[model samples]
Target chain A: MTLLTSAVAAIVCTIIWYKNAPKNDMKIGILCWMYWGATIMWFVDAIFEYAELKAEYFSPAPADMLNDFFLGLSVVVFGLIIWLVILLIKDPKGVIKSALSKKAN
Target chain B: MACFLISTAEAVVTTVAAKQIEKNENLREVNVSEVKYSHKTPFSKKLKWLRNMLWGGSALLLFEHVWHGEIVPFFPFLTAASNPADAAEMLHEMATVGVTMALLVTGVWGVIVGITTAMEKKAEKEDAAQIAEHAEN
Candidate 1:
């Protein structure tokens, strides 16, 4: 489930990036890279879990699937938070900078 | 703190992006640091909305998880599950609720981007007309 969710997210972000490739915004590219990175991380995790569980991995119990699902969502959410923080720091669009300067004056 | 980490990450991201851009001969000598992203660019405006959507959606989801007792500051929360039936229900909630929230955020961002783009175009045309009128005088 983790693998599937992350892959879906990576694919969605990739498609968006592809459509806007000419513009090539850094923020969008960063987001795409983040999701793809997460997907790879979960892929490796799935491989390890499969190795440990062998056949049982192929038929994960509902509880195991649910756990994996939550884990995947957590990873996705964490990725967004990290991205948001970066966006805030960079103030890529100058929104935060203007807001802060306005508050200062 | 998170501010320090994000500043570090920002350096890494900017370096990577600049390196990628440098591969293009035309932009090879461009100073990435000197190039500040303008607030008025269409991409920037759209990204502003997207940032809001994602941050808001993630916050809402966290609140939901906390309310549902799925999240805790302990290891048990990582493995929370009552039984097979309960797990199935949880899976259903994740699929339905999680997907809906993501979709809602994306949909709103898309719509606002479309509207803003159109409005910007209209404003640009009006400005052009005014310049042409002034030049004729």
Candidate 2:
């Protein structure tokens, strides 16, 4: 489920990015990269987990699946936090910079 | 809240930027009404991408959880002790694998954007030079 969750996310984000790709918005592209990166990480994770669990992987206990779901959500939220930091630094629209300059006056 | 204060400050600044762009760009600016809050600069598309990623990732995760019955109202996962299968070990994994994944993603993204932006600027310079040469000829 964890692997699949990240994979699904990567697909969705990729589709959105591609649809408006002509705009090639740097911020959005970065986001697409972030999710694709995560999908890779989770893919490796799932592979190793499958090797260990084999057919057992087909039927995880309900409790374990729930726990994995929460962990997946946690990662998503963490990604958002990181993206926010990037945005702050980039100040793409010069919003934060403009705000700072205004205060100096 | 600190977030609210920061947002307000951002709004004030963006409004000023929008006015400047309006004067200079001849209103070629997109999201004019939102100029004061979050106008689309050359890099703003990435911000849109980020928003979509968060929503899409979140929705997919939720859908998977629901399908697996791991997130049913009947099962209360809020209680950690009730689900020992995902606590200590998961925490360990989160700290190790989770943190590493986040850092790796961020680092890779930073490098990619840096390289691409440089390449883009270089191409633009070449194009301008070609135009000038043609005009001179």
Candidate 3:
């Protein structure tokens, strides 16, 4: 379930970035590749994690691991989002502005 | 927060130095100058790169956690004992997310660079055309 959510989020974000990319900008394509690559890796990792968790079903380790993982991931994602926002804000000449301006036009 | 602050400071310094050079080139119509500034020093460059890597790595680690159903807290704000399997999963998610975020940032940066390049080219072409017209006249 967690994997599905993360995959969905990643795909959605990628699509959003792609659809909004400027006509002349090639970076959006790169972003698409990166997002998809990360998503694939996440899926693989999740499978392995699940298998290991199952093996340790009798222990509380699984639950503890799950909590820590979520907390850490959340922080990272939030941080990334913040960084993106800051970059856009600091550099109006950035891709986000270009994309938005082009859209406006 | 500390990491963000440090990275932001580094970014600001780098951007300022680069932007200054860009501005000088645009305004003076002079050849580019190469000066060894602190911001452009090897140590500074390495620090900037390391910051980027750490951020990207963290994102990937987060994703691994999300994938393994560890995204939600098990104890609901309570700290629990460590579990290697869970920890491994979490680490993977973090690293995955970190990488993904880094890629996204790079893509955005590329777009910005492209835009700037286009603008510069357009300006240069315009100047050349004007000069040609003046010569013909």
By the lDDT metric, which is better: model 1 or model 2? 1
Model 3 misses residue B65 by how many Å? 7.7
Better of 2 and 3 by DockQ: 2
Q: DockQ of all candidates, in order?
A: 0.03, 0.09, 0.07
List CA RMSD, all candidates: 14.4, 13.3, 12.2
- On a 0 to 100 scale, what is the lDDT of residue A79 in model 3? 41
- Which runs of model 3 end up more than 4 angstroms from their true locations? A23-38, A53-80, A83-86, A94-105, B1-57, B60-137
Number of the top candidate by TM-score? 2
lDDT by residue (B66-131, candidate 1, tens digit) is 644666667545234545766676566445444444444456557767877788778777877887
TM-score of chain B, per candidate?
Answer: 0.62, 0.48, 0.43
Candidate 1 ranges beyond 4 A from true positions: A24-26, B1-137
lDDT of 3 by residue, B1-137 (tens): 01122223434565466556556546644453654222122233333333443333334544444444444556431121156565565456445543444444445545645665677677777877887999999
Query: What's the DockQ of model 3?
Result: 0.07
Best by lDDT: 1
A best-first ranking of the candidates according to their DockQ comes to 2, 3, 1
True contacts kept of 3: 0.02
TM-score of candidate 2 on Cα atoms, chains taken together: 0.44
Of candidate 2 chain A, the 10-residue stretch with the lowest lDDT total is A37-46
TM-score of 3: 0.32
